[model samples]
Target: RREWSFTLPAIVHAGTLWLMTLLVASELDWQIALGIIGETGLGRGSWNEIAWGLVPAAMLAAVGAWRTWPVTSHAQAYRGLAGSGLAVYLVLWVVLVNLVSSGDPWPLPYLPLLNPLDVAIGLVLLVLARDLLAYRELRPAVPHLWPIAGAVLFLWLNAILARSLHHYAGLPLDLPAMVQSTLAQATFSIAWTVTGLVLMVAASRLRQRLLWMVAAGLLVVVVVKLFLIDLSGRDTLERIVSFVGVGLLLLLAGYLSPMPPAEDKPTGEDAA
Candidate 1:
């Protein structure tokens, strides 16, 4: 726990330092600063880039330093740091988005709703951390698999409902010319839907490494399509490709990875 005490303080300190840097940087070139703020509308850039990027990446080098000494379980420390970090980051994001939106020429579209995924993931982590800290006794009987199952079910239900609703409403949900090809549309819709399911499930499980890899690959594909492809304002195909590819990769990885040991039950704390 002592390690977490330190780690949380460090992240807070780093975030504060980064925020200060950005405030100073914003003064240098207001246009560029506004551009940075606007980029989030296209689903990129945030305080994470402005502040955290400036910190030495090695700040995490000593994350597990106390593992050997075992003053407190490494898991405990990690949970503490993660929870605190999430809170700090969320507040910073809201504040920065508000600040930038106030002075910009164009309105920041739904700044409050910016980065739904980040909000969702942070909430999940916060819940997990709380469970790890306060409910150690209840972990054994809790079904850790519920997260994966629930996510899958949620995605499946939502996709089905969306399709049904669109059909019943007789809405013209057709893709643009560039993405309207039979194969392209089908490939994208199916692939993305599957990928979303995979991501939801993975997020529920708290698989950090897998989540990061999936997110990175998807981001790369999405960026290429959005910026590089000249689809004439009709770039739905790119998003479909990103979602489908990332989801497929996540599913493959999940299948190949070893399952948790059957007899090694989760502690009560894990369930919370």
Candidate 2:
């Protein structure tokens, strides 16, 4: 029942998985062959430089998106697969960052981290959130609600990812290390928060459900994350950034989606 548009993403995704597994296997020379560390080019040029690998995946995603414009029974699936493929590529980039630590005692630390469970948990939550938001069948009374869920899931994912990376980096377990962790988490929170705010504004202006689901949902999650988790271990500077950055973003969201002054914006749930 699958067509080319439906199947291309699958092929690309499977190819990517096979390629990554093979690439890592050859790089590590695990089991079949021993001793081949540092061949994979880990800790290579600036992380941004390695992004060239993403271009192909990006093009595929664009194709999927374009394909969706034509009427078809499986149009949504095409977009979902395309979007999912794109997200898979992005998440892989994050996972790859920690695989090549300079200090891990293991001879060649390229295996994806799964022992802690947080890494796996974060990955699941983010993927699920994306799938949920992307599903065209989800017709929430308030379309904006979906993005909130997705964004929150991603915030937790980001927090956990950063925290885990810092922990394994083998920094001395002291105040300095704690500060570094907090700083790293805070930096990600701020960046995601700002991005969410921008999307929220865009969603408001366009009055589009898709935009609200991702953008507005982002703000919801970031605010929750700021209070629930990020507040505890962070230092004064980190707190300032969290509060100032998020506070300003909240103001921006408000500006863009300014509330009904007893009448301006729609009152019912459909307004979203």
Candidate 3:
């Protein structure tokens, strides 16, 4: 068992991040920023300001995690700290901002914009999350959190890039918004399906059921998003094409991502 230590530096790290979040997040106007995304597009929106505050915050957390990963005596504590800090940082941008903006004043439900910098920051956090999971020193609390953080970041990156495509295509505004957005959904689904396959393979290698479960969960999210959000108001033929294409994609994923084999029990145990 590892000893838990209460050190000044550890307290400092936690305290500093918490204080920063509270202070900076207080002044940030979520409604206005999302309005920018809805109007000026993802590339020009107020995300630049949010990114200035949050991207660095996420970077700082990931750096702290990497630095403390190798310390023996403090490894466990640092692992917890790293995962906690990372989850908190990523959630601020990924979930919190989106949830807040989607309702209340702005009432825009589409995803918030992510600048190039935010995507880059998300990449860092995704790598850090994997590293945290790789370390057994991480507490049980970790497996539940860091993987979610990584998934959220992954989705955020895809949504951000997808928004650009939706914009560049310049589809007519007269069409139902959902129907117009199907192109983005189909494109994004391809990536999501591919990512899900990779996750299933990773889960197989690590023999972690949770990883496979999350991968399956992601595929489900894509299916639901396509049907409920993107396919609404579309013509019959377009809907048919999407359903057929996505069905084939699911079949491919199922073929490529075999579940781990069941282990044989000892004879006596099996008999018992």
Query: Best-fitting candidate, measured by lDDT?
Result: 3
Q: Which ten residues in a row have the lowest lDDT in candidate 2?
A: 44-53
Q: Estimate each model's TM-score.
A: 0.24, 0.40, 0.54
The sequence of per-residue lDDT tens digits that candidate 1 reaches over residues 125-226 is 344334434445445535674454345434433333333323343323333432443334334444444554456455546645455455445545543543
CA deviation > 4 Å runs, candidate 3: 1-44, 50-87, 97-115, 123-141, 170-180, 204-210, 217-232, 235-241, 263-272
User: Cα lDDT for residue 193, model 1?
Assistant: 42
What residue runs in model 1 are displaced by over 4 Å at the alpha carbon?
Answer: 2-188, 196-272
Tell me the lDDT of model 1 at 67: 50
Error of 3 at 198 (Å): 3.0
> Over the stretch 70-149, how does candidate 2's per-residue lDDT look in tens digits?
31444434444544454555555445433332222223332224432334334544544444444446445335665455
In order of lDDT, best first, we have 3, 2, 1
**Model 2, stretches more than 4 Å misplaced?**
1-180, 257-272
lDDT of each: 0.41, 0.50, 0.57
Please give the TM-score that candidate 1 achieves against the real structure.
0.24
TM-score top scorer: 3
Evaluated against the true structure, the overall lDDT of model 3 is 0.57
* Counted clashes in each candidate structure: 7, 3, 0
Error of 1 at 271 (Å): 21
